[model samples]
Target chain A: MSDKLPEKRKIKSAKKMRDIMTTYYLDAMTAKQNNRQVAWITSGGPVEPLVAMDIIPVYPENHGAMIGASKMGEDLCIKAEDMGYSSDLCSYARTDISCSIVKGGPLGGLPEPDMLICCNNICGTVLKWYEIQARYYNVPLFILDTPICHTQYSPEIARYVRTQMDEYIAFLETNTKKKFDYDKMARVGKLAYTAQLLWQKVLNTTAHKPSPMSAFDAFFFLALIVTLRGTQIAVDFYRQLLQEMEQRIQTGISMVPDEKYRLLWDNLPVWYRLKWLSEKFSGHNACLVADTYTSAWCGAIKYTDENNFLDSMAEAYTRIYLNIGVDQMADQVLDMIKFYDADGLVMHSNRSCKPYSFGQMDIMRIVREKTNIPVIMIEADMVDPRSFSQSQIETRIDAFMEIIKQRND
Target chain B: MNNKERGSIYAGIDIGSITAKAALIKDNRLLATHVILTGYDPINAGIKVFEALLKKAKISKKDVPAIVSTGYGRASVSFADKALTEIICHGTGAYFINPEIRGIIDVGGQDSKAILLNAKGQVENFAMNDKCAAGTGRFLEVMAKALEVELNQLGDFGLNADKPLKISSICTVFAESEVISMIAGQQKRENIIAGIHDSAAARVAILANKIKIKKPVMMTGGVAKNKGMVAALEKRLGLTLIVKDFAQENGAIGAAVLASKL
Candidate 1:
């Protein structure tokens, strides 16, 4: 098995991605100097309008991921707790809030916001989190309330969210003191749709045996889609990434060296332990072929219309994976398991993200009952390494792999 | 043991938080076992227990071909050929002792868990206590200290309780204070001990029920020696637990068994 280990192949797109992201962050950092406006937006919030208005969109959630990946989450989280923010708040929220005051994250904190975009489509916590940040930063705020779509996207729900979308545009205009640009938004929305499709295609490439890439790679590549979704750069980067994946598939290059077992991940990753978790699974000759978390960028793509981007944006954003009911979440998870030919499911019961982690147990049970494949639930915080227990998770992974091996054999 | 039989010996060492246990197996038979306080250093404890077992079996260290370590301190044993998680070790150990065991409920010094096993003896599913000592032996130790009773006496005293008091605090520190207040309120020692056992058992049972634990469950780990805990867990789970004489050494025994295969 060791002899059959695939040679380490670096994705050529990673270097380019770094350059693009560096440029993006640098632009945000110097936005004030350049007389450009910066709008802090939730990861799931509509960024096309902001892009169309020439307002550079910044994601505190993305910054939180950076803080976590750099292992600076604990200090920022502690700082938030010291400032009377509950430790129970999302680590991303805690880090963002604390990092803003301390200038403590990797990039010495995000640039100040001219306005804030709060979307309740991701979770209810974001509403309060954004409100607190808005108060602190003294920025104009736009709140997009997308009701939970339990079963279907009703017309009433559409009308309610669409009204908010119009209000969102007006709010943007008020802050910018300029007329809204419909043509630019149309182009931006089309670019966002293309990027989402390309991302979905890149992820689908893992459906092949001995997957060309793993969810760890997706977690890294996910930054572009979240931060610059409505930009030509994101679409072009993903197109190159998808091509790279296609080339890997053609060359029989595999992420998991042996790739005897394939597992699907659910929920936000333990950001601090991404490499450890990846290697742990790879050591067992198992590849995390797909994940519900990363696929979320493209999960609602079916609702998106490239041509009618603004009109369809309401449904596409509202019916995202986090905003849907547990049953729908389970259905999507089951579909991924079948689509990826997964042998087991590994669910992270994240302590930070409640909306993503809350329905995991039901999803786990649903997948097990429907597919009879084993599901492993690990309790962890996506950002805060303090919440993770290396020994305990190691044991769970080893035992889970043992079970998978037994059934496969 | 004959020299030829001893040459095939495999050793398993389990360095738990409180105690270090070692088991030696030769020709698929339990040759010798040792248990000792792990103290502040697990590495020394692993070496002491392993060396002690080797002397008791009257064999040289070179006679053993493989050594497997388990438990929380498993990684500290640098001499171990392989280290396995206590979950797999416990399940493997339990199944080796009783082939019919479909589940394992292990309550060690600091942690408690329920492990479900398939017919092939592989671990199917498991649930563990959070990063707390509420459902573990440490919880009982704290209760015993609060009750002013010996740890070993807790089992018999609880068995004599007419009506056990209710312990509602899930946090170990709070539960200790609750027990102290109950003593101040003139609660019977037996009743308080029984209440403590009941609460701990109830917490452990949640783990079992969470995973839909299977039947013929075997109880292992240091806490299993306390008859009161086993009884309380059995009552909560409504299943008779299979407790072997070497229940506390089960993980070590399983480690030794795996070493044999290695």
Candidate 2:
């Protein structure tokens, strides 16, 4: 271990990202004062229409990540359970619901919404979650139902989603009391597409030996793309981030101080334990080069056409990483393993995110059969730290690393 | 152990959830092994086991150059040169005992686990019950108390059953209540014990099947001494399991083996 700091590993773009996020949150929080309508949106909801209508798009899921990372998830989750919500419900929904009532989160709580946008592209849980919020806030709710694309995206499904996209715009018009601006939407769509592309390029930089960044870093940098995806700020920030990652690649600076083994992470991160998990892997000289969660922002790149932004988004948003079959999900995981040359797979098996964690066993089996690489499943919640057991997870990680080392040796 | 190399000794102490074990190794050979009740204090159990083993081996603490501690209380051994998890220690110990062994099924005090070993005697993969005591010694102890029988006499009683009752619950608390209800219903004690073993074996088998555990497997840990458990697990897995004489001290022996590297 060297005493000197690793120069390129210190991501300079992180400060700017934080500043941008703080500004975005402040803007959302003070939307009422600014006479700007706020629309609470799901992570997988179409935010471009909100951007086009000048309605501030606030994501509870993103706020849930903040709550989890801040280590306030356990309390918020308990509050929701006390309020009669089942513990089995998604932690994001639980935390967000409780935080709305108690004003308990990193940001005190998300801005109260005048309208709610529910997208089932991610999961069915959001539909109920948003309905609960809409009733509580006395707001109109719009649901964009994107049927699961088990294998392929059919024209009928595409037509159904596209028609809803129009209804989505109409819903925005009704709530915001503003006309639909196609010109601004086209621009926002292009920016969103470019941001996604840059995010992909940033993630792809890990393909280089001794990865310049890790999935931990990706989890942090993912905020802009998730919240303010259609804005020029996100595009600018990602472009800068991409350049820094490329520089780190050229300079041969790795995130893991002594990178020997590279692993791919599946599902959402154990949010509160990010630093501990990062250090644990780093201690073993294993770098989590990629994860399915962070890469999800750009996972459906092939479906988008910047020219046909609105129309193409119908396909792109519908065919996200979580909106597919297990076999297809496994195929994506296999492709990631090959792309990053990962030595093993670490699946979180998150208790909170059912859509992401449900078919993980099948994916693990597929990865093992195809690659013959060791796969470990860690049972935990994305937000709730109560579900995490340090010693149990530590043993699994240590034993997993030993196997990788043995095979490598 | 080579008599000439008795001066160079290594110690491994495993303070598990229910028992503490210590093994002394000299010249790549196990010199002596000791096991005692872990009781309440894991830190004291680690120290007491090491001292007891030293006395049993007729060796001073100064004779051992390195000491490695393992098990749930591995970190409690403040005097050890290093602390390693039970998973690695078990793999190393099982391999040291029989290099031919390709898989390991360890059912400890509070948890059960399955480990797959490669040809090089390294852990290929492993799985354990996540913070559950369904298929562990604790579960058996509770069942023993419920049946008003001695824990050691459980194996013999289970073996004598003509028709084992079915225990459906995967939870120790629920299973114990089920056993109590069975007793009230005038069910035979041996049949209930056999049912308990069957349920435990089912849980352990799930972990083993998940990793696709290889054959030529060996059973380790304190519960391995229970003939009924060994029989039930073998039946569930549909494969023969090799239970060593020093199964209880396997983790401690593996820790000692690991200490040799230090």
Candidate 3:
């Protein structure tokens, strides 16, 4: 008998891996199409938009992430660990190094970048992270500094970013040895804006009987738009997706195909354990009608006639989902409840990503206080599988549903 | 001649970042052992390991005498008769594995922690990298996707690393870009592999230095099994390490052994 055997997969895990890699491929395609000599991007949030830009964007997060998740981040995590970076530093950074040498690393994924662009909106960690990538990959790093947006982007801060953009565009042009076509930029921006508007419309469509789409649909939608932001096919696919969803809404069709307890999901999902969560939630007649992550993309601001493109871009980067703190996060979910006619909320208090995990207790309190909605906190991770205790999350969801049922009754 | 006359059983449980490990020793003879992921529910995973060890050894939970839990999630294990921090377990276990063992660096799913022990395996002090998931078990899981390989293959990959390229993404998010760039550069996979392991080793070595790494260094963790990491550490530190077969499980085994003493 041969030692070689079929790879054991729990279908969804395979899908997740595909999604992750597809995300990589889409970003690579963006670079290839732009005919740019170099492009740099981060893995989670930034890569998606860059992909839509038709410029090849590289994600530094993928490199060290696996090492941290696989009990190996420590080895790679040691250098910063030695410098007093603390074990609590992001695992992606640790494993990014791990992937570099632990065989088949970034060399195994995408190409070296000519330019690096990171935004400060997501977390304070980005500046340091990009700095690392700049040194390690030897690329000129650019910061899309949307100064800590308190409430919203002030005009002054917006202008500051616009100035940076001017420099950044110049740097990008020099690096690519290509001219910056304003027409192309404007066209791509409009297409992206259209995609955003449709996605918002599709999300709004969920208010009908059953949501016109499932969380699974939204997850795929995120990848397509985020990773393929700049392509016509990507835009068309989303437009088609919106049309299908609109039809479902008009026809009174449900995304789950069954009218269950309409619910709201909040925070980054336990990426590795999403299927288990979705399956577990689905079994209880509870379908997630809206997640803040999906909704966050729906309302993306677009600049056209009167709006300055750079200002709009600056606002978009600063106004990311996790940028705002708890009260705003609660308000977003509250809006979803009314829009999706949701019955309850599920909040994932991820141990790995603590920034997103903040004020959930307060958010839960407020949600209960404001709309009288039932809220449950599922302790899990967006990427790492170990943080997901299926039983714990399952039990919590079951209990949360019972609470909802009792409340509804 | 008291409990020794009747025969004593020592069980060690090492709760790790990614997996929980256990070992049972009846006097001098090794009884049985097992490894299981801590999963999302550390309590459940720990208890499951407990049940597994009993079933595997064909001994009732009562016969185990005492059990101990140690690791990132050590405090969360309710089933353990007692809980010892991974620092204590790793130091003690390292000493037991080798009488000369002085420092133990252990990494797990969401944390990278190093333990320093006196000659007697008692912890003098320790340093841990915990705030972020970098330099932990989760790091490997995320990086494997970029490398497109199994976590276990990290050792072989690092060993093959010839052209060590410096990896920049210490934060997992940016690292993705770093890896993607490496891939696009058409660089050899082995060179990138060396860069990753060496950088990871640098992280652990930093912790070693904080404790002031001593001779006859022994490393135990899931990473200890990776040929690339061990080899890289050997090259970096200029000392050979004694890695146990169940390096990852050593904490659990150590915990169990500590349980019997209590």
Candidate 4:
């Protein structure tokens, strides 16, 4: 063996991303001193309107992910449970709820929201979570109730959500006491659309022979698309990210060395164990090429109309990955499997997100019947470390990889 | 002989949560096996079990050419040539015993799994119980303690029940409390034991159904020795299970077989 150490394959853009996130949080933290209105919004909620209205949009779900990554999820989750919130509630809701009172987390809790925007396109837990926060902060809460489109997006459902879009704009105008800028919204919508397209390209770069980046990196780089969407900053950053991915592919730099097997992930990441899980997979020469979670940000881009921004926001927000039927979701998973050329599938049966975890068994069955690859489901919580069992998960992953190796050999 | 002269002998050590087992194989034939309580030190247990197995086989440690370690404490065996998970080892062990076994339901001390095997005895698919002890061997041990009965006696006692009571809780702690209430209500011990077996069988059945396990399934692991649990699982799954000798040491045997290849 050579005496020299192996070269580290760290992504150079990570530093810039971290710096941008730090500045973003700093801006949110001092929003009051800077005389900027901050609207706390859901991860799946529409943020172009907020950007058009010159309101800084904040995401508590992102904060929950940050808390989970910081390994402070257990204390906040326990605090919420102590406060009589059921342990069964979503971890994001629990962490954000407790964080509001305790002012905990990486940035000492998010800036006090001038308004709260909740869109239940992802899960029903957000309604009550935002309600609790609205009552605590004594702010006006705007709820965009997008009914579930099980089979298809019906015309009546579109009309219902479209009317709510008008009401949403009216609520924003009333809270911020400023006129909604349609011209700026047009520009923001186009930028948002471009950012999503660029994000999809960044994800697609992994479809190469050896993935330039894995889903773990996507989970980290995803903060910008979710937090800074509908802004020139997000568009420019993703453009650079996509270029970096292409460059990495050209130089033959893959995330997992000797990537022998490629796997696709499902549901939210176990944030607290991101590094551990990544290392574990890379140790086995398996790269998680793509995931259903990060791609959900760009998955709904097909429904958007760049020119008529407000006209198509209803359908674009309503027909997300979580809002659609299980069969449709299975089809998307199958497509991802083929597109990424996955050797197997690893599904995280998250305990916190009910909607995401509810139909995973059926999806597992569907994937098994439709493909020859092996599939494994790991029970875990995205944010709550209490639900995680490290040794057991380690064994399962090892066994799963062994099966894959057996099949290929 | 020194190590190189007798290279045909291979060894496997399985360091489980409650017990450590070791097996020796020579030229694809079973040589000897030994089992002992793991206690608090798995690494030491692995060494002790291997030494005892070598003694039982009337051979020296130097005769074994390769060693593969398995089970929950697989990584603890620093001397192993390699470490593998119990899932693949169990499937291999069952297939080695009876190549006709298309599926295996292994209920070990802490976890239970249902594995589907292909024609060549390779694991095709598998499903394991979540991070709970509801359907595992530990669940039965806990119930046996509550009933003041020996762990080995639960199978026979459960067989005598005329009407098995229904157990509603899937959580081990809650199920224990439920058992306490039944005892308070003067329920029969055999009936309660039967109920616990059925509840645990029900949980294991989900794993079987998840993988869509085929017929000719083998029951392995320490819990396979319990005839009552096997019968309950058979009834729940609408199929019989094949339980052969050395069911508990199947993982170690499989590991030994793999070590020979290594």
Candidate 5:
């Protein structure tokens, strides 16, 4: 190894981020003693309402990611399979389902939810997943159905989702036994919007020649936007993180030293192998400057109106990345490629995520035809380590980097 | 440390899952090549194959100034100057052999790949089989064992087939059961062998078509030696494959070509 220490390249904000996440989980774990209601919501669900209601918003998908990063996914996934779930089911759902029974995640298990909020905008799997959890906990469940915007978001679709916004507030009122606070929601909505913009700015820092942070860092920092959005905590945390990124850029502290080839990643990260993958790319002087996954938390910001957060959110949440057409998704990807000036694209054909992975082939072809960059698809699961093939993936990445190097040379 | 001062000879070692291969070159011409079963110890196999190749080429190890390694066990060759992926090596090797070759379908012991090359012999694009052994050399090896026929004789037996049967399963284990059922039904051995080739061809053809493989394609790797599999692939892909004398040793040859540049 070089004399330059590994810790020298690490983001100093990481320790602070970890502390915040630990505190957040601790508060949620003791929600009962604090007389706080916990609402387990989907990652793509509108969490601002729950935030405004003073209910601790817990995310099972976030918990799934934690299990994956801690390398507890394989055993939990096997347990779910033993419980008669198909091996092909989403690993997040499987891990969450099994973690409920075994209490076997990084945190023993997530605190029991007083209510559940399910949104189908991200995937159809969440509907069934949340339904199963609702039955398991015997709690109230609210489902928000968003029509897929294959071409354009229509008024009819907007109306349907907007009505659910009212029902969502009513559901929170019924479950928490408190009236909906519109003023608090307005403030939360603005904070959520501000956090997303800051998060986007943080992600865009990678557009610098020597990216201050890699997508791997983004994956770590993404937890706040996903879990603590709509809170001053998330907004304040991102502002500080963004300032650190700008400082790193001013000081020329690149995540990958001697950064040469910049690549863009698609789909969820192989959470368990993030470090391995980071070092592998870094070995080639390649930095994964940006990714579609982390940016997803901020991708639909153009549709949001902070001044009128409630009404515009219906459209914003409905037309998010995974809910749109493949062609539209490809368009967004192409835009990102140009913005980031990426040399290559690495697509993860995740086995567990059907929506994210399904149209990837079409997107890959589109990128190939539109841009003169090399694209490689790695078949793997985000959480389930058993589906990962180390040697095969290594060969593919090496070969892909070779081609990129040749083209750039 | 100048390669020219050290005799201007380059060496390459490719340690695959099932076999170890070595090749040597001097002044842009291939000197010698060697192959042996990789077995369990790839590090030992890599050394043995390289030493055997040097002996065959009448050169000492120190004379070969630059060495490159490729394939699955590429990193096992600790002596190599650089380790490159087989995709680039194969492309460079095929282009060195024939500049007209624009695409390559390499079906190795455990993996199948279709690579597209630019006019300069650089890999433009490529695709590999997923985490499965459905269309690789090992797939045919398993079928040969199930049919109780010698691996080398599979081509002749398949070529004699009057009507090729169709094997439906894309999985190796499931396909073996399909073959057993055909054997129980009294299907001819030659026909069963032909069916097996067709199944493997169909699977490999998908990789070729996925990258839209270009014309004048070259076939490499151990599976290229099977005439029946070649014919099936030709029929399925609607293009003839260029298989030369060094087909099985192509990866090693490519690695050697890259070593000279190092």
Candidate 6:
């Protein structure tokens, strides 16, 4: 992070090449000129803060996730394993590698990451994932060390992240040959925060009877927000989106209408198991009204002031996902259930996502005690299709539904 | 007393996370069964279900020769004379109920499980999804609640769907979203319901597919009562499902059957 600029923008040509490559996801959508560059905003690591900087984001994790679902997970995993990457490491790592190799991807096939940022928040897999990309297409890699906190984040960790974030801006300025404008960024930060506030407001809109938003819709919003958090366009986009939801709420239009039993879902979904989950309950006329992930990510607040944006960005950017606390997680989920007017609860006992799925039983008990709501614990994994069993989960759901109906009666 | 008059009364408690079910067997014949909500406390729920069963049978706990327990919270019940795995109990119970049953699909509220049994109804291979409610009793409960229908009526609604939806994801969160999308598309409620039933059937098919599903899949747990889901599943696999009359209490009955064997 020295104040040295390369003789020629080493990445200028490379960024253009990557944009030309990634224009696939804009399928059936608006076509853009070369002025519209694609960005990859990597998940779990130093991503949200990068928006504060004026570079388009490119997330490598989403690419990896796509690879994980395709035929490439085992192949990439074998390659990584051959290189001594342990099998015990998350499959997401292998999936990212596969994504790099596979020609197939979402959003017109994702663009190759221009600048890579790695944070310790999601874990070491990201460091390795970014390292592979940085070497593959030579680029500047910035690593942000989010010091783990016990009770509250130690100031030292905050200092470390602040220093890294400062260097990131310097790198962007030098590479772009643009002078750092604190005022412009601060204005953008304020705009970004407004967008975030609107997004949060949209999520809170579920408080309306027959919520205008659903967890599925939130995932889409997350996709947009993650990619466009710090931009004015994002603020406008969210403002319009919130307005639409406001209309829905005003009209009492339910995302899924004819609501009978409302339920709060916990933890990450078993991706391979989603089809079965929807049909089983929808067949029975039940809808999962809310979940921990949608609520948590949907509530992400943006900090718009760049002058002292360090604390706000750090707090919002490195949220509960960055800070692991089971009790805090449980409380947030419990609060969301009531907010959604949910009648029951679902806790996914995922084997893959231990960081998210652990303490599910304890959380279930607490939710039941506090809300007197029926809590159903179903087992599955985040990505690995092998970990899910459909029948046992159905049996458990059947019992929970009976309780709901009985209670309603 | 005559030598043929000795018919031991056996009680089995299946203390699952979502529900506590109890079964009473006298002289190898089913006497009574009860299934009740776990409500916050599994142990107390187990006791309540057991008391309710005894009351239904008009008999005291003293008359029972032995009591056994099974399920996630089975070990927590101090009153049970012995504890058995839900696996062992389910196999025994399925075999006793229908000797032709080769597979036991026991879906509970908190979890969903697939247990493979031999001719003897002993567990040979088993797979369980105790991690999520995507394909279990809890899933159906949510859907039924959404429909404003009783749990008992879910199967009927599913059967009437003129078209069935293909729910693409198994995660409950995504499933709900998928349902919303289907509803947004102005799909029929019955078709949506049928589609949901297929989703559960597909999940069960995954577990049942793992091992050799010879014949006569004994679909149990609260989900078995849904004729829509079970029938839809039957049409999908081109095989008939043997749903027990009191599938909700099968786990506890399985435990009692295992107790009788022990």
Say which candidate scores most in TM-score.
5
Per-residue alpha-carbon lDDT of model 6 for A114-207, expressed as tens digits?
5667766655556666788788767777776665443565677667667777786776666556676766666666665666677777677766
Clashing pairs in 4: none
Model 4 CA deviation exceeding 4 Å by range: A1-7, B1-7, B184-186
Interface RMS for model 1? 1.8
RMSD to the true structure for each prediction, in A, is 2.4, 2.3, 17.9, 2.1, 1.3, 20.6
Spell out the clash pairs found in candidate 5. Answer: none
lDDT by residue (B34-117, candidate 5, tens digit) is 999999999999999998888888889878889999999999999999999999999988998999999999999989999999
Report model 4's TM-score to 2 decimal places. Answer: 0.97
Clashing pairs in 1: none
* Per-residue lDDT of candidate 3, residues A141-206 (tens digit): 877776765576688877887787677777666765667776667666666666677667766666
How would the candidate models be sorted by DockQ, starting from the highest?
A: 5, 4, 2, 1, 6, 3
Interface RMSD, all candidates in order, equals 1.8, 1.5, 16.1, 0.6, 0.4, 11.7
Models ranked on TM-score: 5, 4, 2, 1, 6, 3
Candidate 2 Cα errors over 4 Å, as ranges:
A1-8, B1-7
Clashes of 1: 0
Question: Which portions of model 5 show Cα errors greater than 4 Å?
Answer: A1-3, B4-7
Q: Which consecutive 10 residues in model 5 chain A have the weakest lDDT in total?
A: A1-10
| lDDT of candidate 4 over B25-141, digit per residue (tens) | 876778888989999999999999999988888888778878999999999999999999999899888888899999999999999999999999999998888889999999999
lDDT of 2: 0.92
Query: Which candidate leads in lDDT?
Result: 5
Candidate 6, residue B54: lDDT: 94
Task: For candidate 3, give the DockQ.
Answer: 0.02
Question: Model 6 off-target regions past 4 Å?
Answer: A1-40, A44-54, A64-87, A106-109, A174-177, A272-275, A298-311, B1-262
**Could you give the fnat of all candidates in order?**
0.52, 0.70, 0.00, 0.87, 0.96, 0.09
lDDT of 1 at A323: 95
C-alpha-based local distance difference test score of model 1: 0.91
Give the alpha carbon lDDT tens digit for every residue of B1-262 in model 3: 1334346676777666578777887874557788888777877877788789879988887676666776656667776676556656766667666777776777656556566566656654556653455566677677777988788886687677667888877777776678778989998777777777776777777767754676766778777777787787778777887787777776765665566567
Q: Quick one: ranking by lDDT, best first?
A: 5, 4, 2, 1, 6, 3
**Model number with the top DockQ:** 5
